[model samples]
Target: MSADTLITLDTPTDGTTVSGSFDAKGTANSPEANVPWRILDAGGQKVLHGHFTAEGWMDKLYPYAGTVDVSKLAPGSYTFEVSVDDPSGGEGKAPQKVDRSITVQ
Candidate 1:
């Protein structure tokens, strides 16, 4: 992932395979130390969504980690995404996000 992006996913990288529960860790510059994330099925349907708090926030990029349970999901392809929305509600900028393809097996 590019360092320029506000969020960077370090684990379960692009095309990674996962099973059961997996850890998603990364660095971010998000609001209130809240890092939002989601998993979308191949058909573009949201399967899971939630947020995790980072170790720190505001002044710089901070580390964040969360465990995503996928045992309930059917084995298939999915997109895992992490993003930081513009706290100002898009007054003049867009949200920063990063995503990668993952397969549950």
Candidate 2:
């Protein structure tokens, strides 16, 4: 995963509820399908990170989704990213990153 991925953050009216989804496209007729994601703050700190594995319907769906808790976070900006990775030196591909700046008040 590169450092240029984009993660978009959606802020609701409640200011404490935050949720969104991401999609990592799969290859054509390929059995490999998975996307790793990470949520981080402005200080390069990791808030949450995980991998999602789901089958697609003939390259019709990318299948990536997650929900984050903003109640524990202070009023500030943050970043989220998703990437396709393999442990066998194939994880250097460009990952999707989304950065969002939010204020509590």
Candidate 3:
């Protein structure tokens, strides 16, 4: 995590072409000890969801790597999102969400 950003994805970059299942990479410093991800199909439907855990969470950011299964979706366009786990702060708050647009070839 940077001073200005919560999480960042380093692979399957935005507006990139991909095929089948691929490795997802990023880094984050989340209180949950893990960061969540969601893969959405062209019509904005969730195709897969999971989380990535680093070696351990400290006061600094840690690296996260995971695999996203895209073998079943008849995809043309999809969004791969990685977000620092945002637990509610006891108020009406939204979770942090970052997204990458990917096309399945």
For residues 1-91, write the lDDT of model 3, one tens digit per residue.
Answer: 4485657778868898877888888777776678888888877888888888864565766788988878887758889888877666636
Whole-model Cα lDDT of every candidate shown, in order: 0.88, 0.45, 0.79
lDDT of 1 by residue, 13-83 (tens): 89999999789999998988889899999998999988878888877789999999989999999999998
Q: Give the range of the ten consecutive residues with the poorest summed lDDT in model 1.
A: 1-10
RMSD of 3: 2.3
Residue runs of model 1 more than 4 Å from their true location after superposition: 1-4, 86-92
Clashing pairs in 3: none
Clashes of 2: 6
Candidate 3 is scored at a TM of 0.83
lDDT of 3 at 73: 70
Q: For all the candidates, what are their Cα RMSDs to the real structure?
A: 1.9, 7.3, 2.3
Ordered list by lDDT, greatest first: 1, 3, 2
lDDT of 2: 0.45
The residue-by-residue lDDT of candidate 2 on 1-105, one tens digit each, is 333322222332222324343233322111255556566777878876775554542344344444444455665655655454444565555444333443332
- TM-score rank, highest first? 1, 3, 2
Give each model's clash number. Answer: 0, 6, 0
